[model samples]
Target: MTVKDLATLTPSGYPAVSLLMPTHRTPPDNQQDPIRLRNLLTETRRRLEADESVPADVAAAVYDEIAEAAAHVDLRQVGEGLALFASPGQVHVRLLETPVHERVVVADTYEIRDVVADAARRHRYWALVLSEQPTRLWSGDGSTLVEVTTHGFPFTHEGPGGTQGLPRDYGQNPSAHRDERHRQFFRDIVTGLTQVDALDTRPVFVLGVERYLAFFSAEWTAAIAGTVPGNYDHSGPHDLHRILAPHLAAYQAFEQIAALEHLDVARGANRYAAGLPEVWQLARQGRGAHLLVEEDYHSAAWIHDDHLHPAEQQPTSAPAGTLVDDAVDDVVELVARQGGDVTFVGDGSLATDGRVALILRY
Candidate 1:
């Protein structure tokens, strides 16, 4: 399933169970996935039964839904990881390439923002390869590129040639004439893209040789601003992936820089928050406009009465009843449920010891 599918889920005021775990894409790993899933379901059942506050009927309903979800897991459809969400009368399982830590969360809402952000990073853009021959279009995440057909394109390159109903041949000034044609060609491409139902709001990255790229860049539209200067016209999908890595990396870096700029602006305006405690408070109150968490940062913590109790280390002496998992995961979920944005950034992006920061809506 897509991230959009995950985002549209509305809480039903009933218990929502979220299960995330590493699953196998291939054998050995794949072989053990069923066992892992079974184990998770067992844990989920135990948690539901142990929660004395949950109504028996509601707990049973949720558990049965979880079982139904587990029953449909096709090994062939599994990916490197798996995420399952279950609530009364609803269940969704998404296969993902990014591995998530093994965790089970039972709450009133689903913890899905991290997965949504991951999906965006991997598969949010369309790659348009501009060529004199067959102009190609691809839907891609950072890791994979799937070619998509654009009907009636490579317009001039195809049908007719020469003057009358034929391709034009600029005599001596072929270079200048061709340049102007390319300019107009790119303009038309921009217009076409705007009307394309498939393109939507996803960013477009144009790939072509230096000359064509220069021409396209001059007439660049906001819809298609990213241009990669290269010649990969004959490359297949695998080769295209390799070609795209550097460009995608550069794009993500640019996004990170922009996020930092926004954070700086928010801080200057006194509309920002830092560290876990403050960010958590804002998140609980739905005051978070944007949450920026350091990538690979996780703290064991749990919420009680809307307060975040964070533990720096797995304390030798712990509270009797505390839900300690990745606190950042809860932060992401809270921001997402409030319709706020969440961004996972590089280690030092926040420049704070807490490794969590927020841009407040107020």
Candidate 2:
């Protein structure tokens, strides 16, 4: 979708922009007053609301103007006043004024690790995480982080003796090590997702190396089925960003589609045989939402006024193809004339569960 289309989907609750400022330079002596900072923010907000096409240059000018007035304020202190805004229908933006540092710790030895596992059994539930090292699993139900001990690996050692003792064999099989690492990763991520307050019962999306992807897909499918019972359904093996993009897009599309008055069809048993009449009725009434046809079914009979109007008219000698093909063509024509969407499905797929599900307007 175009950016304009996306803008139309913006939610109503959140602010359009967030400003973040970190503590760095001292505010100008006179600008140290909170009132001054508040006034600057007020001015900026006013300008933004007034200009339909506010550019970066204009924004910079506003900042400079504020800085000039707050001459006594340390620029660093002003920076800390910057706020983060979570825009509607947009990726959250955080303004950072201070440098954030990450610390790394290398374990002296390979050991079993315990990680938390949180499983969502809902069709829309999904979770994603990015990490370089294997993390310990913790309980996602509000308990403290649990350290799951690993049982199948050994840590490298290099001390004053220059690693003199007999070296413990990590593992003979490379695949085994990969499997263990992934198992821990999945567990930890699920735990983290469960801790998220916004997520209800929904399917989760997991992204990682190919090996982890395969392992998690298989294990998660089974785990969810066993845990939540009948609420799991998903499609993925994509990167975190890829998975999220589609979800956001689908949400937007769903919102737009929901706004329009439309018909929906659910196929029932004997759709191939019994559906012909309903299909014809829907077409005749100009209320067909979409024509759903099973690829495996064959026929050539045209349907009109709820009755099969065979091209040959002679029921005794007509080719079997005439019965099905004509019916499909008739349905297609009817739906198109009425401006409806058509979706064809494989014979055995879920789409064909019913003969022909016709979504109707009435």
Candidate 3:
């Protein structure tokens, strides 16, 4: 889930079940994903049913929705982790390339820490290949690109659509009719992105020839990330990734440079908090305006007495105060939930102890 979608989330109904588990991409290991998912669902079902605050119907709806989502979990399509969030009738499923620590939290709100941190570290976007025969949409994360099959993607030009659907005017000029049909087809794609898949949000990056791009641009109103004007219609995921890699790198490089500049300005104003603990405190207080973190920085920490301390191993059961598996992810979540920006820079960008720094909103 992107931070943009996280901002729209709120605690709803009774128990908000957040089920996350590590998934494997290859054989032997991947075979157990379905069973593991079922186990998590079973646990979530038990917790929801036991909670008296949750009405029976509401509990059932949540379980059914979660189960329905679970059924669609294709191990072949998944990356390293699968996260599912369910509250009453609402449900959200996300696949992550980074391995997620398995946890079953039945709380008032969805556990979004790992999701936030992953989204920050792994750049995700949409790669749309425009074609009249069959326009395609792909989900891109870092160097990988996967085709999207749901929400009526891979849309094709259905000329006249035959008697089953609507019939076009046969009297119109052939070229003009084809042009209108193409424009209308592109418009339908826009409608799907904004209307049909309204909740599924991402920065769209278009890949197409000049002709189709012009057609799509003319019909689409929403802002796109950038366009690569070429014929990638026949390109597979690997080839498409190779072509998009340079573009993605350029985009990220520009963003990283801009973020470093922002951090420098914040430092000059004495409005930044360096190191994890200091940033943690400010972030917890909703004072984080922006967080700049080194990409590989991670620290296991114990949080007690409103303070954070470095830990060698994460405490399994928190009899102490609380066991923060990765305080860096926690800090990212805290800042993001507070409407703050987060940027992951090169691993050595921050020379601080925790390799993290926060620009205080204060």
Candidate 4:
């Protein structure tokens, strides 16, 4: 998805990201160092949570430092967090710990299916169901059929004279039926889409045949066009957890980016467009969670009060501003200090020209 779409998909109100790092602690060879290693982990978690913007590089550096400090400790085994991605809509949960040499073993092959089913049960919203069957019916809280169609042979056979015997009956094969079933499946989907369009929540996940996905895309593009804001995944089979995981991760990222971008845009409005008193008024009313400003006008001030008392009281060395400039800077700083996100846009860019929008009323 485009970065602009990412901004729009973010949920409006949230605080403090839930960072899940399910890792296997390798016990140090020296029995005496267990406490020390545990302390190191605790410190790492604290450091990560304390930062405002902790990028990947900063995390790596912090990890390296901690590892070096614990050199004397003999940590043998490492476990990877199987789910390391962010959620789709509201919460942006990231998996920090990476897997090492050992591969994660799923005791039962059907375990993935069970996980997906459980998630569907928990969140009854837009459940994107996926499957490998033709004309298979999914009857969950909000279920839809997905007919996967692939143009490939299911199996191969050999003839008596060292010649390959091709299956002449295409319609009888499960794969061949997928296409036909999928075409029929869209009728049900379009009905659901009509109902879903009127609702306020996100659309349910539907995983199924490749043909189903193709039909869904075309229908959505033609039917809703610019109205739908969120991104969806139609890839792979519907084993509850696997299908839902990536969407969940993406949802989480969208929210985080939205909150941050919104704050930036609000800050921009307060600074560069001081003539627009409505912008500052919105900020005061807590409606200014996000702001969009031109990237070139990064130096604009965010003023809050109409009077220039703050700038006037500054010493001679401080930068002087006209009454207008002071008023703008006051609003910009006010928004920034109050935890709003501001996004700087380049000139002629969508964001600079009002194409880059924010969700204030949501």
Predicted model with the maximum TM-score: 3
Lowest lDDT 10-residue stretch of candidate 2 = 112-121
TM-score per model over all chains: 0.70, 0.25, 0.77, 0.29
Across residues 1-362, which tens digit of lDDT does each residue of candidate 4 receive?
11122223332222112222234554342343345446545655465545556555554544454344444323333223222111112222211133212122211111121122112122223443322222222222222223322222111112221133233565567444544444445545555544543442343444544544665666554322111222323332345444455664455345445644554665565432232345556555655445554333322233334323333353344354344332333334334444554443344443443432333643
Stronger candidate by lDDT (2 vs 4): 2
* Candidate 2 lDDT by residue in tens digits, 22-70: 3344535424545544654665556555655645555445444434444
Query: 1-362, model 3: which lDDT tens digit per residue?
Result: 46756644665666788999999989999899888988988998898889898889888888898889989978787888888888876888887777898878888888887777777788778889998657888888776787887777878776653123444567767666667777888888877666533666666788999988998999888887788999888989889888888778777877889988998998899999999878898888999999999888888788877888778543455456676789999888888888888889988878853588888887
The runs of at least 3 residues in candidate 4 whose Cα sits more than 4 Å from the true structure, single-residue gaps closed, are: 1-125, 130-181, 222-239, 271-362
Best by lDDT: 3
Q: Local error of candidate 4 at 77, Å?
A: 33
* Backbone clash total, candidate 4: 59
lDDT of 4 at 239: 54
Lowest lDDT 10-mer window, candidate 3?
Answer: 159-168
Q: At residue 265, give the lDDT of candidate 4.
A: 62
Stretches of candidate 3 exceeding 4 Å from the true structure: 130-204, 210-229, 236-239, 312-320
Query: lDDT (CA) for every model shown?
Result: 0.72, 0.37, 0.81, 0.36
